[model samples]
Target: MSLHHTASQEATRRTALRLLAGLGLYGITMPSIGQAFASDAPGWPEAAFKAKTQDEVLAALYKGKLEMSKDVTIETPEIAENGAVVPVSVSTKLPGVTSISILVPENPYALAASYKLADASMAMVGCRLKMAKTTKVIAVVEAGGKLYAASSDVKVTLGGCGG
Candidate 1:
């Protein structure tokens, strides 16, 4: 067999082994992913997560109105083939950003996730959010005791419940 052909076969074998290992690890962790989050983090905002509508969720989380700011940016795929695991990242150049929250308007629960940051912490956060269907993803940043928001639409071809 030619050396080039042998090398290609070796690369394919390595890729398959990697995929298998990753799948095994993911399967082991899948069960624990639904476990309750245990931490010292105060202000869980349980009500916000239970809020059904975007307006109600915003009111539940923040005391004041949120300002749409170009300074805060939400990064998400324009089209997600699998809604089960859509990657999202939120960041802001604004100062004193204490918290970041992800919102999905079309989901049963409007508030998908939230993150807390301190004065010395970075103003950026990344998470994987499940979307039931195509919808708008909003990032809300609490900075300097004020609310700022940025949004982007993601088209989910498949519902996030399962395959």
Candidate 2:
């Protein structure tokens, strides 16, 4: 083939190879993504929605520690339809939390939230949360070797996981 044609073909082949490689990588990662939820973080209770009260949820998330303070703030909608996917945000007006966690009492899992503090100065973070029913959502902040907590209720109607 002519030089120009040869160059054009080479470029096309390179692009095609890159696309296939990307797809292959995505396929390999698909299963592992779900694995992140395979095990609950340490210090979390091994119970399934056993928390009938907000304090129970906070205690579970904190795992018996009064080190938490009241600086942590929990944010969520006053109402929600699909319990499976809810938006939650946590912030601390005090200083910073070394970690943050979310919990829903009606789901099969009690430990619905967990986060490790990357920066001691980071005052806030948000996440898309999931619920199983109309339940209270709690956010726990671990800072200064203590656990501080806040909570809100979300009323799920349609249920996100098709309840």
The clash count for each model shown is 0, 7
lDDT of each: 0.80, 0.63
Report the C-alpha lDDT of model 2 over 21-58, residue by residue, as the tens digit.
78766454345655666544323344423566555655
Candidate 2 regions with alpha-carbon error over 4 angstroms: 1-63, 66-70, 159-163
For residues 5-66, write the lDDT of model 1, one tens digit per residue: 24544575455556677877645534464568643122355677889999998777677888
Give the true-structure RMSD of model 1: 16.5
Top lDDT: which candidate number? 1
- Candidate 2, position 118, lDDT: 57
So what's the TM-score on candidate 2? 0.57
State the weakest 10-residue window (summed lDDT) of model 2.
1-10
Error of 2 at 87 (Å): 0.5
